[model samples]
Target chain A: MHCLWCDADMIPELSWKTIFWLSRPTYLCPPCAEQLTILKGKRCGKCSRESDEEVCPDCRWWAADAAWDDPLVRNYAVFSYNDAMKEMIAKWKYRGDYCLGKVFEGAYQTAFKQAFSFLSREAVAVPIPLSDERMHERGFNQAKMLADFLPLKTWDILTRNHSEKQSKKTRRQRVTAANPFQLTRTVKHPVILADDIYTTGSTLRHAAFVLKEHGCPAVYALTLIRG
Target chain B: MDDYELSRRYAGKLLLRHEILIDEPRFEHLLNAHYFTSETAIQTKWSHHECRRCGNQKPSLFGQIPCHHCGETHVYCRKCIEMGRVMACSLLYEWTSPDQPWPSHPNACTWEGELTTAQQKASDLIVRKIQGREKEILTWAVCGAGKTEILYPGISEALKLGMRVCIATPRADVVRELLPRLREAFSGVYIQGLYGGSLEKDGTAQLMIATTHQLLRFKQAFDVMIIDEVDAFPYTHDTSLPFAAARAKKETSTTIYLTATPRQEQQMRMARKKLPHVFIPRRFHGHPMPVPVFHMCYSLKKDLQKSQPPKAFFKWFHHRKTPGRQLLIFVPTINLAGNLTQKLAAILSNSTTMAVHASDHDREEKVQQFREKRFQILVTTTILERGVTFPSVDVAILDAGHTVFDEAALVQIAGRAGRSPSDPTGEVVFFHDGKTEAMREAVRSITRMNKRGGFH
Candidate 1:
């Protein structure tokens, strides 16, 4: 097989140790896979950033607000938003290389099972949806692709109103902008919101706000990367 | 917007429709006034699978994306997606206006250096062709024949006639090397150097030097387009670059193709009298091309695999350790280059040798250090085959029979030797387990050029 990014020939190596750990061979070469900065070590409870503080400054700001009855519970991200991650996301999302969604499939599956083990089997995985125009252009919603790899029952419970892409907005604008997500169906079970990347935590928070405004009792989030 | 501002900004420029929308505040009035015309970037009908722009019918290069604006599925060409997405939904805007009078200086040629007699003759022919209405001309010169100097007179003629000119090459490194020389030669003319990360994309210039990929951003922009290294990689193999080159020039503009080793197709065309070409077989210093000597070494890769340099290669290296001569060894791949450099450094002990390839981030610095004589030998891949000249350098090709080394590449590699006038003779050795047709063709081409002799 050839690497998707560099087109280098990748001969699969047979080793009992690797097979035992990884279950299956990796599609990416060693060097190309090394470029990804996998998130590890002590992380913030709210945003899953590499942090020593129990509650990071951004999470403290979100918690200090009394506007909402229940604050954001927790979030988990699998990778750090390094330059390589940024480029990979751009190629996969903006360039419409849908095949690249599989690069994160194995990692996302492993991370998802580990992050949300406390939730029951009936807890639904609702992917953050794209507007109809974005869905038409991109053909497939990237967040839905990530959620498809989760071990939970996935559902399309939320819909997005047409607005400027969150990627094109500044942090202050993103945090202060009006919520663009609306609940399309009533849900009583616990929920896990899935997105490709968590930037500033405003997008997931907005989705969580809409879900909480409805009848959902609890909400959690999982993302591919934390920017 | 003022008519002058609109014309100055958008005239002779090819822009994507999305670019226009992003800059809508500036182009809104002009677009609405019908001053700008739009053409499909990659023309295609729903029934046809072939792309009109690049003529690619391969399914892998074609993709379908739902168009948000038109509410239809649009098939786009993905082969030239690096330039931009060219789809049925996309439009390329060209400003339709009267040609603005270009500024020309009285004395555009400021170079004091003299050209050889053969170069002067070729320069005259090129100048005459450019001044006349010839559509295409080929300048086929031997390696180290001072091909860049021969174009000076022709370019100066175009500049004096108030015509916009462009000197485009396939590689960005070539563009970087040619820019300063062209700037020094034509000091009076405004020259803009363009590449991937270039910042000088705004201004209008009399002479524009750019890579072939940058030509995609231009539309009928040049009156004369001179493509250097016409047979180089990516340009020769990829069809989109040649298409971009053709699209960058005006309908009536002249094109000059400059290359050291013309491909077989070009040679056949010239032989049939279908293409006009000029040939220069000798270097400016009156030296014939260096013929490479092939040495048989049994399984060099196997020997290197055991951490042993082949006996023949080591013997040659030990014998050719002269005082001032630097050695350049070309390997097939980057991994082999690194291993060979390590083994050679251990064997030589007294001399400093380094390996450089495309992925080496410090490649420019390493090359600059080699030029400064800090390294005695440099092991590299084809990344250094052309656009680099080191005086008093002996070249050796390991595994010359490797599939990566084509006839054109081998010729360019051998041409690296004997470049300096002070030391007109340098050794070129090809150590291979078996000789391939490419090696034989390289030797034969050099012998043929040598027989033609220099124009005195």
Candidate 2:
């Protein structure tokens, strides 16, 4: 098999369990997987941002906001935004190499299972939506693709108004901008939002705020990368 | 904008929709006026695989996804994705209007040097082929036999008759190196040199110098197409490159292939007299090819594995006839090149020794510094085997029996020596532990070329 990102040949590892049970196919080679900077030893209790304190400053700002009532959102990211991950995401998202999303399938599923296990009840995976203009431009929602890796039911219960890309905005602008997400349908079950990146936790918080206002009991995020 | 001016920019060229970058209203008007033709960027053949833009049909290099625009499964070609996203849902545009006439140049070539008797014969053949619009011809000249100079006369003749000419090579380094020399030769004509990330995008030049990869953007664009180093890597290996070259030429155009070593099929065609051929056996300096001296070093791999310098290398270094000549050592792999560079640096106590490979970020800068004599020794892989010239360098191939060092590569590596006219004779050595058939053929080919050059 060839790696999805680098196109290098990947020799499947043969373990005792795989001899009879059959191993899950992998889309990334070992060297390409090694280049992904998986996040480790982080102190942020909420966002998985590598920090010395219990919560990162960005998450602290989201907690002190007065617009909503006791908004508690937790984000789980598989990898940090390293140069290699940045290039991989750029190729998959902007360059329209959609098959590269399969490279993250194994990692994303493993991270989701570990994060979603703590929920008291079953939680549905809700992908952060893109505006109609953005959807037509990109032709596919990247968040929706990552959400497809989850085994649970995926809910498309949110809609977003057209806004400038969060990547081009400053930290202050991102935290202070009006929320773009609106609930398409109400949900009573716990929610786990899936997105390609979680930067400053503003987008997820803004998304979570809308879900919570619609009488959702809890909201959390599972992201591919943490910038 | 003038309709002709806008359409002329895209005449005889294929461009993705995003690459057109024009006002949508104007583009639509041109389409309605029947000046532009549009088609799906990617075409699905009977096998359900094909990239219409680059002619890629490899199933493994294609991907399918649920496209939001079309609301169905869209297959995209990943082979040529670096150029642009050529998907089934996107569109490729071509201008169908008549081509704008190129201005003829009365005097194109300004080079004052004269070709040797052997080179003059090949140059005249090329001119006649271009004039008569023959299908193809091969100029099989030995390395350093004034291959670039022989093309000036034919290209000048073609440009004088208001014909579009393109000189495409397989390497970008050759394209960059040839552009300045071509400009100096044809000073009055408008010439454009194209490669990846090049600034010149408007392909309206009468004379063009481009890499074979750049030819993918052209469609029936050139009247005379010259392919230099026709047997080099990626061109001979990749099917898409040759397909692009064939697609870039008009139906009735002349193709001139330049190479030091033609593949077996090309040689067969020449022997059968199916393809016109010319042979220049000697260098422009009137010197025979440097024959390589083989030295058996049975423990070469063992020493390299132990991170120690081989004893045979020091013996060869001390017994060198010209110790002051620059040193070029070719290894089989990049890992070996790095290990040997450190080992040689420590042994000779020379800090100027460096290693270079295809992916090295400072590759271009290091080659430039080596040319300026900033470094005394360069350890490299087969990437430096062809299309590069170091005036006076003694060449050495460590591990010459490795699978990577085929017959063609060995000959090209030996050709690096004895290139300069002033210092034409440099030592070439193959330090091997075992002699393979490829090594034998490489040595035999060099001997045959020397004999054909009247060197006995």
Candidate 3:
């Protein structure tokens, strides 16, 4: 086997204790794995951003704003948006290396379990949808692939209108921009949004607000990176 | 688009359908006029599998997915995904238009530097091979023998004949270095340099300097193909690159390989007299290549674990010949390079010492800074083993017996020393815990080259 990111040959280390627990195999080598700064230490309760307080200031603003209707939205990210993660995401998302999605499968599974551990009822993974024009260009929906890694049922019931990418907009612009997501069907169960990244917590908030308006009980987000 | 511009840009090039879709009306007109050819980008019919773009046929490297365009399960090639995603539904574009004659330059070479006697002989042999339309010829020249200068005469000859020429290497750094030099040498000709992120894609230039990976976009494009550093990485390992190189040349094109350390198959072919060959063992400065002195550092690993070099390394550093020259340390892994860089920086109390590897984002800038003497000591991996030159730097290998330091790599790493004409003699040391066959073969090879260069 070879590393999905760097293409270096990965020699599977065999030990006599291999019969123990059946954990998912990692797709990264030691050095590449070390580059991933997983969300650890003190973090915001609402968002996974590293913070000393219970909630980050940005999440606090979203809670105080009347326009948001004080929606219940919490985001859990797997890794920090460091330089290494940024490059890896660029290669996977923009450069269209589809196999790189497999590199994060193990980590995504772990994060999915941790993020949904507090759920009292069953939740469906809802991938954030791309606009029609962008979908044709990008070929595969990254959020869909990420949602596939979760053991829970995935419901892609959200449709997005053609809007500028959140990455291209400023934080202020992203927060103030109208919601691009709309519920394609009435939601019966709690929703967990699956996305590749969480930047400024606006995209998740917009989706969560829409789901809350549609009578979905609770809304949470599971993202790969906390930018 | 103008007829002349279309003919010049796409006459002998391969482009993706999306690349040519910018002007749909003109493309449709050209298609109706029989001036364009289209084919499926990925071939997955029956048991046959191939990627028309990068020529990848590995079944394992292909992925099947629900394609948006085709609205079905489509196979896409993952081998050359960095360039672009080539799926089964995608189309590749090629111009079937009549070939336009390239402009001729009677006196193309503008380099004023003189080649040495051995270099002049090799240059003449290259010119003869190209003029005779030979299949291929190997130029086995020692390091610092002015391999690039030898190609000037041959390229000038080809340009005088109104033939397109290209110099492809495996390393992008070489393309960057060769672009300026080739432009300066052939000032009258239009030159294009292609790499991973290069913006210029006109492909209409008469002279091209590109990395081998960039050649996948070309089809029978050049009349003369000069592959530099033929034994370097990716070229030696990637099977698709050699296929790309062959497909990028004309039917009767001449390929001239330039390498300092030829691989085993090449050596065997040369021995069997089945391949035309030329050898230049002398450097441009007429100095013997630096021979490496093997020093045993038994406790090297223990010392490095504690973030320090062995005492013998310090002893050699304190009593050095030409201590003012820059130092280059080659380690087997990136971990060692980073650890040693920090330890050396602290011990020497100099902030200029740094480490670089293949994945370093600031690698190009660091190398440029090192060229300008901004860094006194640079630690690196095998990424700098070939296709780069530093004027006056002493070279050392920390783990010379490591499996990564093969014979060819050791020779190339040793060649980093004694490159400039002014600083002809540079020190080289191999600090190994134990000697390996690769180290012995490297020493023997350097000694044999020195003997051929008339050094005692």
Candidate 4:
């Protein structure tokens, strides 16, 4: 088999676990996989960035705002926003190489199970939605694709208004922009928000606020990468 | 976005339909003024979505990407995606400006150096063809025959006649090396180098040096096209590149194809008198090609797998490791390259060695250091097979019988040695468990070339 990224010959990782259980094979070569920085060590409790403080400066600003009753909840990320991850996302999202989504399948499943262990099994997982125009353009929502790997009950209850991409906005602009999310239905159980990338935590916080207003008791977020 | 800026940005240039979006302000004015006209980028119709650009018909390489701007499922060619995505919705754009006048000088070429007798003859014939009615000529010169120098007179004559010229090659490294030499040869000429991420893409120049992939953007834009390394990889294997090269030239433009090893089809065409051709069998330095010696060692791979180099191979390695003699060992795969580098490193503990392949992040730096005499040996795959020269370097092919070692590749690998005129000879050894046809063919070709002496 060839590596999905470099097209080099991929030697099978012949381990005892693979031979005994026949686990799903890896798509990337060892070096490419190693380039992915898994979130570990000391990190901010809210944004999952490598930080010495309990909350990063961005999260602290969110806490100091008088518009909300409480600060944003914690988030879990699988990787940091490195150059390699940026290229991989460009290939998958903009280039429309949909099959590359498999590169994160196994890792996302493992990270999901580890991060949400404290929550009950009945806690619903909802992917932040793409606007109708974006959904049609991209064919599939990336957040929904990541949610497919989770074993929990998944829902598409949140909808988004058409707005410019959050990536194109500055931190101050992102915080001051009007919230673009709306709930389609009220939920009583706890909900886990899923997204492909978490930046500034404004989008996730906005989605969490909409969910909480819709009667959801608690909201948490899981992202593939933190920028 | 005005007419002056638009003309300055895109005059005499070829661009894809999607590329216009890169500079929206300029494209908007061009669209408003109707200065932009487009043609179908891919030649074939959309029944099967076969890419005429890269000749890739693989379903995996053809993607149906959805675009909101058009609200349609766009089919794009992914094989040449690194260059840019060419989709069914995309069109190739050419500026509809009047032809720019070519620059002329009393003496277009500033090179004062003299060519060898054979090179001089080839240069005269190439110039006559360029100035006459011939559309194509093949210069089948052997390796290290100073092929690039032979084109100077012809290119100068073409420029003197007020024609636009473009010199294209398959590899970017060759273009990078050739650009400086060409600029130095013609001091006053406006020469622009075109490659990926090149900043001179918008310039209007009499001469353009670019990679073959860049030809896809042009539509009969050049009056003269010179294709170097015509038989090299991705050019010979992909049919679309040659098509693009042909399409980039005018109806009556002159094309000169230069190669050391023309394939059998090219040879047949030459034999049939269809392709006007010239041959230079000897090197510019008048030295013979180095013939390879084959040694049989049974089950060498098995021995190497057991962390032991075959006794005979080790003996030969030690014998050749005299001071100041650099070694290059070619292996079939990256795994073997790494394994051999480790074993050799353990054996020659006092010497410095490194393994490099296509995926190595430091490939360029390592090769540069090797040329600087910092590394004593380099273990590599066919990534360094051609377009790299190291004078007085001896080469060895481990597992030479492997299927990947074809005749053309083996010949190119052997050509790596004996390149420099100062040290025009070196040892070439093929260590294999069994003799293959490719081995015999490489030896036969070298010997045949050596027998034909340089033109007096």
Q: What ranking of all candidate models by DockQ puts the best one first? A: 3, 2, 4, 1
Over 4 Å off, model 2 = A1-19, A29-75, A80-87, A128-134, A157-191, A197-219, B45-47, B299-311, B317-319, B335-349
Expressed as tens digits, the lDDT of each residue in B1-456 for candidate 3 is: 677877887888888877664477877888989898899888777967899889888766777778777789878888988788888888888888888899888999998989889999999999999889899999999988889999999999999999999999998888888888888987878899999877886667899988888898899999999999888977888988999899899999999999999999999999999989999999899999999999999988777677677788878887888888899999988888899899889887753699999879899999999988997999999999988999999998887998989889999999999889889989899998999999999999999999998999
Q: For candidate 2, lDDT tens digit of each residue in A89-191?
A: 9888887788888888888889877777877547888999999998877778889999888887899989999999999999999988998999979999899
Write the residue-wise lDDT of candidate 4 on B337-446 in tens digits. Answer: 88889988998888888999866778878988888889898999888887777776888888899888888788888888888988887778898999899889888877
Candidate 2 lDDT over B210-297, as tens digits, reads: 8887888888888999999989977887888899899899899999999998899999999999989999999999999999889899
Error (Å) of candidate 2 at residue A73 is: 5.0
Docking class of 2: medium
Error of 1 at B260 (Å): 0.6
Off by over 4 Å in 4: A1-87, A94-99, A102-191, A197-216, A225-227, B1-14, B21-34, B40-47, B52-55, B197-199, B303-310, B454-456
Q: Which regions in candidate 3 have their CA more than 4 angstroms from the true location?
A: A8-25, A120-122, B45-48, B305-307
Name the lDDT of candidate 2: 0.86
Residue by residue across A1-227, what tens digits does model 1's lDDT show? 66655546777777887777865646577888988978989999888988999878988888878877544578899999987788778877887765566778888888887888888988999999999988866666888878878888889988998988888899899988998988888789898999988889988999998888887888899999988
Query: Between candidates 2 and 3, which one is better according to lDDT?
Result: 3
Every model's DockQ:
0.17, 0.58, 0.60, 0.19
Q: Candidate 3 — which pairs collide? A: none
lDDT of each: 0.82, 0.86, 0.87, 0.80
**DockQ value of candidate 1:** 0.17
Interface RMSD of each: 4.6, 1.4, 1.9, 4.6
Q: Highest TM-score, which number? A: 3
Error of 1 at B74 (Å): 3.8
